[model samples]
Target: MRTNLDFSPLFRSSIGFDRMLNALEAASRAETIDTWPPYDIAKTGENDYRIVMAVAGLSQDELAITQEQNMLIVAGQKANSDDVEYLHRGIAGRSFQRRFELADHVKVVGAGLVNGLLTIDLKREIPEEMKPRQIEIRTGQGMPKAETKQIEAKKQAA
Candidate 1:
C-alpha cells in the first residue's frame, strides 16, 4: 500500500516533546503486532492497569520480562524437545515477543506467572507536589499576618 502523509503545516505549528511525537508516529505504523498469544489489557483502578497475556505451556524460567526506555518487552523461548517425535503438534511452542508502550510516569509494579498467564501490573503515580493545587485568591493583601504567624507557630510547635 502506497500512501502520502501530508504534514506541511505541522512543521510550522508548535510541537512539544519530539520523543512523544516520535512514539506516536511509531505507534501509528505499528499494527496490533500479532493476535497470537492473545492478551488482555485491563484497567484495575483509575490509575492502574494490568496486562494479562495467555502464554500457556511457558514456564517462568523460560520467559523474561524487561523494560527498555519507554517500551516493555515480554519475550519467551520454549526449550525445544529434540528427542520427542510428535504425531500431531497442535500447539506451536516456538517463541514469541510482545511489546507495549509505557506512558509517562507509568512504572511497572511487578509481574507474575499464574496458570500459564503472565500478569504484569503497572501504575501511574503523581506526587503531591506535582498534583494540581487550587490557589485561593485573597481579595485583600492576604490573611492577617498575625493570624498567619500564629498558625505557622502552631504548626512548628506541633
Candidate 2:
C-alpha cells in the first residue's frame, strides 16, 4: 500500500527544505522497503549513534558501505559458491542495498562486524561557527561603554 501526499503547499511556504520534504515524500510513496537483513538504530551518546544489521552469511569483502553527500548506502552481495548443497535453505543470503539519510554535520565514524551483526558508528560534529552561542544583552540601568561614547560624540556634534 502506498499513498502520495500533495506537498505543493509546503513547497511554496518552506525554503531550503527541499531535500527533507523530498525524502519524506519518497518514503510515503514506497510501499515495501527491503527488510531482509534486519537492522537497528541506537543512540549511544548525546551525538553518537550506531546502526546494527544482521548479516549472518556475508563476509567483510561481500559488503560495501559508502557515503555520498548526505546519504549513506550499504550494499551486500553473497559470493557464488557451488560447494554447499542444502535441501531446505532457511537463512537468507540475498543481495540487497539499503540507504539512510544523514543530517547536516553528521559523519560516519567507523564500522565493524562482530559475531553476525554489522555495526556502523556515526557522530554529529557540528562546526564551531555553526554551534549556538549566547548573545550579551543590555539592561535599562546601564549602557555599554562603547555605546555611551558614541552617544557623547553625537551630542558634542549637535
Clashes of each: 0, 0
Predicted structure with the largest lDDT when compared to the true one:
2
How does model 1 score by TM-score? 0.78
lDDT of each: 0.84, 0.91
lDDT (10s digit) by residue, model 1, range 20-81: 66665666666556787899999999999999999999999999999886789999999987
- Model 1 worst lDDT run, 10 consecutive residues: 149-158
Q: TM-score for model 2? A: 0.83
Q: What C-alpha lDDT, on a 0 to 100 scale, does residue 147 get in candidate 2?
A: 47
Which candidate leads in TM-score? 2
Q: What overall lDDT, based on C-alpha atoms, would model 1 receive against the true structure?
A: 0.84
Q: Using Cα atoms with residue i matched to residue i, what is each candidate's TM-score against the true structure?
A: 0.78, 0.83
| Cα lDDT, model 2, residue 67 | 92
Q: 113 in model 2: Cα distance from truth in Å?
A: 0.4
**Weakest 10 consecutive residues, lDDT, candidate 2?**
146-155
